[model samples]
Target: MTTDRADDRNVAVVTPWYPNPQQEWAGAFVQAMVEATAPGCDEVTVYHNEAWLMRQAPEEVEAAREAHRRLLPVALHDAPTVAGARLMRLPVPTVPDYTFAELAQQHASWLRESLGGEPIPARVVHAHVGLRGGWTALENARPDARVFVTEHASFIDKVLEQPDSRDMYEQVLDRCTGFFAVTDVLRDRLAETFPALAHKIELISNPISFEAPRPRPVTELRRWLYVGTLVERKGVGWLLEAFAECHAGDPELTLTIAGPGVLAGALAKRAAELHVDHVVTFTGEVAPDEATRLMREHDLLVHPARWETFGVSIIEAVAAGMPVLVTRCGGPERTLAGIEDAVGEMIDVEENSESIVAGYHRLRDRFPDGLDLAKGRRVLDERFGYRTVAQAHYRHWFSGPEAGEGAASGGEEA
Candidate 1:
């Protein structure tokens, strides 16, 4: 299952977020994108830039450096094989003296140096997010190389919040050979923010790595699920209030919040104060299989992110034929675009508590009744499945050097 062509499709994928033993689901989507790319190329090598001390606990930081001072590169070449790709994990020791761009350059150069100081002669360097990885790829790009950047990071939401950040981000974006956005709305937002590159910004949805699992029957007690890090922007507190609203009317309702984060204890305590703690369960970060099982068993998924570029979890839920209630906080609204009939209504973040409560009630009313979750899944596959996303990347990968660019979608449906 290897390519017959000479290794022309060789690509170097560099990213800040990548799955490691310590962080299993940190950049699972980026890995899925790489896997989707595997079959087409001669060989795809991934360089995960894990900046040490950059985000580590203070105590763990000193201990980690003492233990792994060598910081050597290792080949983790198999197991989760992607037809034609090789996995290389490099653990980097962070130097606080470097700025984001400087650190990123060091990361990319280190990878290039690892290959015996040979300038990587890959077709392109694809960086998963815009933060530093995208800028790094641009800086390290060979004179003739094509550099593709995908800005699916939610930081863009925050970037837009501040004047200086927006300028700094766009300065990095200007260097990309091409830019990919996770949703059409996001593409539009990027274009609106930086009209100069609007034509080059293209719509590229996040790929769903898993197939639709066989869904379970709707439980008699009506199980509700929420899968993601429980953080402030996730609107877990708002969800607790809304959940209590629903439960006050129907004692049979149960809400299970999965995934762990800084907000877990607080959310649980809030749930207790709301008197729904008896019914609410907080199961800290389960494995993927357990997550899929939970998605299958539950009838509804409540996702109320204050901001999101795109919600891959919604795609997973739709695959399991589970209904979801989301907020139009950002990009998740795009998930509802073509599948509104099946997905029903999405809540407006500006809405009051009663309105949020009402949206949940509305989603429950439509669940399993007239809702064909499979129809939503069909729409998801057509738009966000691996094949669709990979093909989009393939086109970008092979685009002639003269194709030039604008911040744009390739005029394809997002």
Candidate 2:
């Protein structure tokens, strides 16, 4: 994957969020995008600018910084290469008090220092997340490089709340050669914040693979699965309660909660208190491939999320031939647009268990006869399959005579 000559067609990916030992699900979408687009490029390298938060006593702050300075020199090449792309994880250590703009600046500083203050070698750079990766890439990429940014942050509202961060975000949009959002929800949010730059943001989907369908379309909906962080905002608490109610009615029912989060311990304890711990399995932080495997092993995807920018997991579940019982959260509403009934049931977002319970019942009642899993799969694959998204990237990244300079004419599909 290494080459002596830096081809003008080489691509560099920069991002603050990436799958790591501490958080395996952190940036799986970015990884998927890289995996999709790498084959067409002469070279691809991922610079995972991991912003590691530091909590230290005031007296030991300087010592912690010194330790980080020593550790970072050797840590750059420690990440495992993914999808034939060379991986470099540059850990940017910082105190917890920095604002979003400041944190982004810190990532840029670490990236610059790691590269010995040199520009990224690639002529084209694709960055995930508008603030951290986008800003960092803009600051560190070669002057002639065309930097494209994709916005997928769930807490974009919070980021825009701070004036400094919002101003910096505007600069990112203004400077980047192209900008995309994974869903209309995120695109509209950014557009609303900066009405003048609305024309710059366009819709692009995260790629999903449908090469391996489930062994068989699920005949029954007894096996329930939830793949996401176990946190209140994700509606995991409500999922547990709803699962308990469902299990009580059907003793054979089972639930598997995958991925890690702050509420893991509490959720397990609550499951025990509900007396359904026997059937509940908590798989903490599975790798992306394992998460896909889990989708195949189960019959249903129960995503009780309060919000999502794109709902990649839901789309993945459908790709794996599993019916989804998801909420009408921001992203799912758009992602599952016309194919809602064919794929699964969509419940209104709520804090209690009632909506999920009702949705599950509705999905079970519809089962095999009332759904067209094949049709749903076909529609989603046409929009988000690896080949489709990869080609879109190529058209945008290498369209013009100079390559990556034809951002204005990039595909404008919704």
- Residue-level lDDT for 102 in candidate 1: 59
- Per-residue CA lDDT of model 2 for 221-326, tens digit only, reads 9989999887778999999999999998999999999988999999999999999999999999999999999999998999989988888999999999999999
Q: What is the lDDT of candidate 2?
A: 0.88
Residue-wise lDDT of candidate 1 within 1-414, one digit each (tens)? 332223346788878877666766678788788877777665787777677655567677767655554444343232343556766666566656555545555566655555555655675788877656776666666666678888787766655666555665687678788889898767888889999878888888888855756545554326889998888888877887888988999999999998879999988888888998999999987765577788888878888888887888887887776778888877777777867657555888853567678887676666656566667778888888888888888777755533322211331221
**Least accurate stretch of 10 residues (summed lDDT) in model 1?**
405-414
Error of 2 at 293 (Å): 1.3
RMSD (CA, Å), each prediction: 5.3, 3.7
lDDT of each: 0.73, 0.88
Candidate 2 colliding pairs, count: 0
